[model samples]
Target: MLQKRICIIDDDPIYKLITKKLIQKTKLYSETIEFNNGNEAIIYFEATSDLPDILLLDIEMPEMDGWEFLDEFCKLEKRINKESTVYIASSSIAIEDKLKAKEYKCVKEFLSKPINLDKLQKIAEQN
Candidate 1:
């Protein structure tokens, strides 16, 4: 199987750290790229057209929040980009958050914090 790429965008280092560790344990991807916030990830994607196979984004960030990132990202030349699997990982349980996440077509699903292997496997399948 071809190794998949997964990007993690979160301001929390612990989330990024644990997620990366979990991903490594899965041995499911060639690499897992991480960003402390959404703007950094957006900047990365803008410079590099080779987008990840999947994206794990957090809703809240200091700059370029997840919603903004999604809005700006989808507007980019859709032809030049492949459909990167998106999973919104957040601690927010607000119904509004879930509803807002679905507004973006790129988002495949939303998972609450403390992501586990099961969620990772499911996201892998979605990829």
Candidate 2:
């Protein structure tokens, strides 16, 4: 598989650290950019040279929530591949959150927190 760009946006430091390490292990991404909150991620995405091939975003965050980030991000066409660039990784098991994420076509899928290596590999395979 080709190595692609990956970005992870989450407020939890531990989660971000662990997941970033796991993501690196996959050797699937040419580079990995991380943000502590949705707003920062959104800002970077807006100004970045190219959209990450894969984006791992948390559902909830301070400043800008994932939904709000999506709203802003959707307006930027260069930030993703149609319907398959971003994935939601959250601790929430709320059906509503998962269902709501589906409203955004760029959201590849929703995966629960403490991201598993298998899941990341699977995401790479899918998108």
Model 1 misplaced regions, further than 4 Å: 77-79
Worst 10 residues of 1 by lDDT: 75-84
Each model's C-alpha lDDT?
0.85, 0.82
Per-residue accuracy of model 1 over 12-56 as CA lDDT, tens digit each: 998889889999988888888998887888778878777888989
lDDT of 1: 0.85
Query: Local error of candidate 2 at 51, Å?
Result: 0.9
For model 2, the local distance difference test gives: 0.82
Point to the candidate with the largest TM-score.
1
Indicate the TM-score of model 2: 0.90
TM-score of each: 0.94, 0.90
